[model samples]
Target: MDQQIIMKIDDLRMYFNTNGGVFGNKRKIVHAVDDVSLSIMEGETIGIVGESGCGKTTFGRAILRLYKPTGGSIEFMGQNITDMPERKLRQLRSKMVYVFQDPYESLDPRKTVGSTVGEPLIINHLVRNKKEYEKRIAELFEIVNLDPSMANRYPHEFSGGQRQRVAIARSLASDPKLIVFDEAVSALDVSLQARIVNLLADIKERLKITYIFISHDLSVVKHISDRIAVFYLGRVVELSEADELYKNPLHPYTKALLTAVPIPDPFLEDKRDVIFMDGEIPSPINPPKGCPFHPRCPFATDICRTDAPQLVDMGHQHLVACYASQEGRLPK
Candidate 1:
């Protein structure tokens, strides 16, 4: 199969202006996402992982145009949509949808599960009559492994897992080509999370849908993602195949994140050295001068503090943005 690039994000940035300092005299800029670029391949799941405020969610919203980017271009299916009109963007909504973290909040409490799932179909004019709408809703329920008979029940009637299934069903209602799962399973129990992750993988295989799975849990993202991007303070520090990244992380932040994931073997777990970051994550309003991670990086040098490094491709398209990694000083 010929590889296809479904979405391309170039130099994407999202910033929010707010009152400056305690006096609130001047305006300050919150750098949510800064100069990040990546391409999503058709039928592949790309995971974005970082701490709570590392801009993973903002990056996803920017790609979907939910948050209009502050700078740079976004190309979806070869069409530049960064500056596209809202009227035109609405037409593309049917082809792309977002599955939020909390299903309870996303699904309507007042509406029946069937109605909730069918809303997108109605909005996109996917069905002609009431019968067609109900039929499509039933099929969608079954697609996500939910019983069609439960369509009439309210969202409160279902379990957490089931509600997420409904949310997935609703997203699938539009027959979207790309679905952004923004911390989609972080709210569910571990077992439920596994079930949803497997369902997402199965759906991708069956429907050939591309996904942008965002989560702070490295383990969760590792299970569902083909490639993973590690974010640090609104910037992508490293990006590579999931397996390769876990086994051989080049960036200091990436290595630290992997070490934090508990190992199954007691011996390996005890033997592994965990890297602890010293200070808290810098404020986005006034980040550090050079590399964002320089303050906490163990190998930070004068160059690292004075000059930021761009994401450099090492080999096999594995990229990292760190002076140590580029200088071959990273531990083997």
Candidate 2:
């Protein structure tokens, strides 16, 4: 059976205006998320990976209507929500939620963990009485592998990992259908990250929830994602199944990112050649003409400097946006 598409985004563009001139009089537009389109299926975990400032987080927020997109359409659950009014959008908040990067800052220092977890339930009117609320809070805490007894404590009392678990608990309080996790485990240690990733996988199986996981760490994303999208300068450069992307990356930027991931086997790691990219990422406010990655791509051609390449399928559902890949100029 074909899986239902939970969310569909078309030509999603999110631009930000900021003062740029010396006198602060001129307004410059920053292309945070430019002409990106994707479809997320129900019960699937789609990972968005890229360098810092590549619009991974912005894309997630834009789809969730946390930031009103400058252009494009966002359809969630067969409803067009791209320009939905705040009042109407509020009603959908219970079904779609965001789990921020910093658990420390996301939680209130003054509020107890139990209250924090119950905030969504209270706002969505999920529970009727105090007893029902407490029972739901306990269930949420237990789902995240957190002790219900610790719910009475403050956010500052818990460790970074524990705090993140608390945040997860809060996000699940209303039984959301789709959750966007922006760098959810980036702040924790390696061990904690693995544990949290495992917990999320377990929860997804038990609850049948859909997730959009955004992060710059490809290694971490590989473990949790079913399909991965590689972003560069606010656009998707490559997208494919997680294992397929690692096995055969057609885009230069994707190849470079994979090379940077350290292999566990010392002998194989030493034998592999690393592709080092030249130059820094271009500023979003004044991005270069033509292809966004042409300036740093080693295989860039004349056409690459004059015309931007759109993402095209290269068989087996692997999509790439490189002129060299399309023209068969890149070495196999």
Candidate 3:
């Protein structure tokens, strides 16, 4: 049997217009996500890692059709949805859901947990009557390991971890095929984050749900992802299997990111090679020419300064966009 491709992104771009431009118009574009392409397989988690402004969240929103793409296409289950009509998109969204970073903010204080979880089922007509809706809500709560009796409680009544579980329950209420976890565990404590991550893994194994786990923390992403995509300034600089990328990072940006993740053992941590990235992230608007990371890359050459590199396969399911790596010139 062949692995199912859940989502395909082709040259997707999400640009925001900044204030002031040539004709006194807000034509200065901030390249939030630019010419990025990747595919997601069913039943696997894909981690997107980068600094805060690298556009991972924007990419997720664009994939979910929450933000209209300025260019390129997004295909979900082999169907093109980049320009799909709103009515059709709404109907299709039942299988595509998002679990936001802050559960407290995602859930409305005015609504009870039961109502919040049942809202999607009711709107999509998944349940025939109120009793059935309530039953489904209870099931959702149970699925996330929450007590069904607590369905009547409001958002304020639950702890942070419990609130996140409620958000996950709400997302799963409609039996989604894919879930975008936009830093879903970032706001929780370390212990709570671990539990939630385990819960997510359990949910994936039981329900076979695909996930796009976005976060800046390498450690967190490493723990949950099957494959990882490293983003820089609005573009994906590298992508590879989680272990392969962590063990052998090809792109300069990726190398820097991995270096920053501290090792657990004190001796290993002290002896580990660390690369300090100089200068801050470049502005998306009026970004540097050629490779976006050339300005800060230690191994940047003339080619890197003059031309951007495409994501090229480097064997073993690894892909990188860097002149040095492609030329086998990357330092050992």
Compare the candidates by lDDT and give the number of the best one.
Answer: 2
lDDT of 3 by residue, 209-228 (tens): 99999999999999999999
- In Å, residue 95's CA in model 2 sits off its true spot by 0.9
lDDT of each: 0.92, 0.94, 0.92
Q: What's the CA RMSD of model 2 in angstroms?
A: 1.1
Clashes in each model (backbone N, CA, C under 3 Å)? 0, 0, 0
Candidate 2 lDDT score at position 55: 94
Task: Give the alpha carbon lDDT tens digit for every residue of 20-39 in model 1.
Answer: 77876789899999999998
What are the clashing pairs of model 1? none
Candidate 2 lDDT: 0.94
User: 2 or 3, which is superior by lDDT?
Assistant: 2
Candidate 1: C-alpha RMSD after superposition: 1.3
Write down the TM-score of every candidate.
0.97, 0.98, 0.97
Candidate 3 TM-score over all chains jointly: 0.97
Off by over 4 Å in 1: 19-24
Index of the highest-TM-score prediction: 2
lDDT of 3 at 143: 89
